[model samples]
Target chain A: MVAHATPKSNESKPIAALLVAAAVAIVGILIVVPLVSVFYEAFSRGVGGWWAALADDPDTRHAIWLSLTVAPVAVAINTVFGVAAAWLVARFRFPGRSLLISLFDVPFSVSPVVAGLALVLIFGRQGLLGPTLAWLDWKVIFSWPGLVLATTFVTLPLVVRELIPVMEAIGPEEEMAAVSLGASGWQVFTRVTLPNIRWALLHGIVLANARAMGEFGAVYVVSGHIAGATDTMPLRVEKLFQEYRQPASMAVASVLAGLALVTLVAKFVIERRLEAESRDLEAARGLENTRLEATRP
Target chain B: MSIHVRSISKSFGSFQALDDVSLDVAAGTLLALLGPSGSGKTTLLRIIAGLEFPDAGSIEEDGEDITERHARQREVGFVFQHYALFRHMSVFENVAFGLRVRKVPSAEVTTRVEELLRLVRLEGLGGRKPSQLSGGQRQRVALARALAIRPKILLLDEPFGALDAKVRVELRQWLRRLHDEIGMTSVFVTHDQEEAFELADEVVVMNHGKIEQQGTPDEVFDRPSTPFVMDFLGNVNVYHGRVENGRAFWHGIPIDYPAYPHAQSREARVYLRPHELEISPPGAVANRLGTSLAASIVRVTRSGPITRVACRPHGSEQELHVDVPTETARGLQITLEPGTHVAITPRNARVFIPGPEYSI
Candidate 1:
């Protein structure tokens, strides 16, 4: 006897087509149009205009360098913290686990400006840790350090949020199995847990990197918008727009947009690869089950 | 090596998973912890493997206390119910994991892993990932991986629970032979009574986080020490009544019952296996076994070699199942059909004074 009664699939083709059309139209307006428009406007003043905005404009050059420098640092710091946090939250049970997980979501929930404000409240000149930091001759409020700090705060949850679900789904059974097989704690994590989570970790890192590179409000509040020192790619785009350098603004915007596109593509590829790997694993298990059933007496 | 588990008690929040459970495994003996889900058999196995810690009690391996040791330090090989083989690793790498983790020589790891792959009868398939192997094959790989460490004790938690029935039986036989050859002190947890009885030299039956009985297969089957054991092992008819003057009265009829030290309790429960009860004509007196009750056949079912007759005692709502050889039913002159009255005599029955533990 069949266990489940099959659901009818007599959906109207016209309605399905209408739904697909609606979705495509929405994506076209929101994503495709803006993406095409950025490149269109960037090259409106010709290739020299684009190159002049990027290379000739020293502030924009500094902004590019600043973004490049800060994003990697933020991504690197968050990557280590993300894996550790995911491991702690997913593999072990403890009091306040939900609270810790919720705290990770704070960056996602709260406004980016509020996150920057919170950081400033703690690290600004007259802020809580400011006096002691100043005693150590540390100027954090309008420096590269503040920009990195704000970027790190804003992008902190990206990798961690990506990792938690994957780690939790992977479960503790494999780790326990490793431990039972005489693997030490470190060995178990390195050999078993790390391999299982590596793909998800990479995906998380990509997302975190993308966010760190594009972060604006948090970095803006902490950066003080120092022309050649603290201005990031997004801040530079805003500055160029205010100066009526439309092509330069669009040019910097286009670069950020291009990076965003690359991030999206990388994210898509990683997710697809993960999906394919899981599907292959599942199909292999199904085949194995069939073979075992065939060989059964 | 022999292992001793002493008064292990573990509680998870408000629920007690194990309550003062103790067991011993003789050297090179195969033991089964048999219980239904939530009965702490798996918990006990985990505790013994050092994968879980008991809130109270001590565990010793070959007379050495190892309760405080980490699972890695305990040197116990554990096979999970789902065959927790490393999915990313090939069967060879999976088997070599333990040795590699211990930093065993590369040549020895390869030789030992090959030997184990052959032992588990998956020699040529070692290069395949765990996902590429059948459930039975994966289970064997898990076993081989556990054995690679040459552990003193091997623990398996429902090792064949995930496989189909046919494969389960095949793996059970293979595991029996494997255990005999390896001669490791193995303790396996399973809820399947048949698997426990067939695979282990000793079986510990657990219920509600406590051991109900522990004995040889025949001993536990033929003489269950508790009502839970009797019911858990096989189909049994239970008769609840009042006991007085060394006899238990069911439906106002006096029945023979084995006296218990706690017979002072007015309430009693009698357990008789289906095969232990014999069916004859209403007034027929066969061999003098025990009390006979006049019952009307409620239903008769013939399946394969056995004919089961379900009958209700006169004026009693409880139904008793009696199984007889189909040939015996054929030889009888009377037709065993519904509505035909028969005398059901209990060849043996266990009488327990009613208590909370005796309730199903």
Candidate 2:
């Protein structure tokens, strides 16, 4: 009886199990093994070796600090830009709306190297606005500002893409209701619209922050790789690896991998919480409907 | 406060949503704007609420022009059809939102919110979020929130449209009772004729972005001013014919036309409610007093106390519906089974000159 208790779905159980095993093997070989190898190699020379490579080396410390500084600034600027762009695209219909939306997706499709090159063409020392900036004695390229500009350009679309669909689904009806109820324009937005899209906005910010922290290609092209000044963590890792300090290179690589892990965990927790909240809302709706039916005459 | 809307018109792109729409809401009365989809009922309601600006119109409240005022300054309570409760707010906070925005004292805000929660019959459910409320309860929360501001007039855009049929009826009765208790000037939009008839002191029937008829429920039902209103109001059998010398002729048969106003019109349309068309035995004596047409029963449907008989006129493909009491059908010894011969007599009918506007 137990053997014959297999349902229709059980017929494919062996194939499903085989496919899942294959997926797990691929991930172990491609991802888990490499991640473990990075940490193992970083600590191969013992903790003192890794600590001296990361903390004792002044250039390495400066590279870490520079990365930490650039990420938050890029994320902050892009967050504001993303929210405003999403609102404009989702809330109103105007000529060239489709063009504007397509332009928001440019950063997603374009190469980061190309994005950096475009920024250089506009803001480089010999570029279009170069003379004006030089006259003001404001240095952008080959500096921290250039690194931030490149990172922001590369990560700009993350929040806007996340928020546009959510805002469109929420619609203007709630905002209209608030306004009709004597709320000022700002009050309506803060009280009604923001709460509706807060989860999506937070998810976007998390992703944008991750991208801003991890972006290397555009920053490499813009930073000029000046040691102890403009060189970021990724550039430092490359430099250490080329100089035959394999352990030091792996140590820096391990830190970046750890940040990636933190981002993944945060994403997982946020997604789980969002799912639970929606499920709870659904359950509450069901309970209310049952109670309403029971109370009806 | 009374509201007077004068010559309101709104257009989007190439399509007109409202055309020369004018309406007046007396103080302490409920008016229903009843129309099919795309008939501008909701548009007019939004205009009155100041949620939308009319291309050409002025709105006056309490004898003061308020057309240019912002929605926040208009002091009109608007309830959206979807309830539009803030998803993240509790029912208590939703009802207290207007008061909070107005800087009401915390003590007074709590008291007022609690009072409104009691008024809307959600006294123990204040802590629950809107997502935790049923459709009817959410609508009540919306009403309570709107009333929190003590608006001069209340506007609801199909408030009961999202509920089940049973809930709709119950909410209709509850809304009527609430309006009676508070006596606020209220306007609601609905496409349900029965709801409009049963709930409102006045009914405005709209079609094609214009008001076709506006009157008391009985007046609109009994004496529709336009063919659109007549068709929209209830199921009616229409007969196409011509009027000449104060007589109407249809299908080679003379139809009685008493005091016909459109006697000179060559094209005429007569409307007869299903109930007004009486079915009798083929040779009944009552056929002598009215225009009787010979027909064979095509179908019969019995529901509750009424039996609807669908009959095909002799020598014609069109079918005319007649509603008779089951008791009367039995007393007359006339069975409404299919293929049974019967005579359909129009007990009362209204004639109108047929034109483009008459085409529903």
Model 2's CAPRI class is acceptable
**Model 2 CA lDDT for position A239:** 86
Measured by lDDT, the strongest candidate is: 1
> lDDT by residue for model 2 over B79-163, one digit each (tens)?
9977778878999999998888899999999999999999989999999988777788988999999999988799999888777
Q: What lDDT score goes with residue B162 in model 1?
A: 70
DockQ of candidate model 1: 0.49
lDDT tens digits, residues A1-297, model 2? Answer: 254565755687788789999999999999999999999999898988888879988999999999899998988998889888999999989999999999988888989989888878888998999999899998899988899999999898899998898788677888898899889978987888887777778888889988887787888888888899998888899989999989989999888888989989888887876676567556654654664455333
After superposing candidate 2, which stretches have Cα over 4 Å from the reference?
Answer: A1-18, A277-297, B250-265, B285-290, B333-336
* Pairs with backbone N, CA or C atoms under 3 Å apart (clashes), candidate 2: none
State residue A132's C-alpha deviation in candidate 1, in Å: 1.0
The Cα error of candidate 1 at residue B302, in Å, is 1.7
lDDT of 1 by residue, B166-192 (tens): 888998999999889888899999888
Task: Give the alpha carbon lDDT tens digit for every residue of A1-297 in model 1.
Answer: 232433433445567678899999999999999899999999998988888879998889999999999999999999899999999998888999999999998888889999889889999998999989999999888999898899999888988998898878767888999999888889988899888888888999999988898899999899999899999999999998999988999999999999999998999989997887678656755664665455344
By summed lDDT, which 10 consecutive residues of candidate 1 chain A come out lowest?
Answer: A1-10
Show how many residue pairs clash in every candidate, following the order shown.
Answer: 0, 0
Please give the RMSD of candidate 1 to the true structure: 4.2
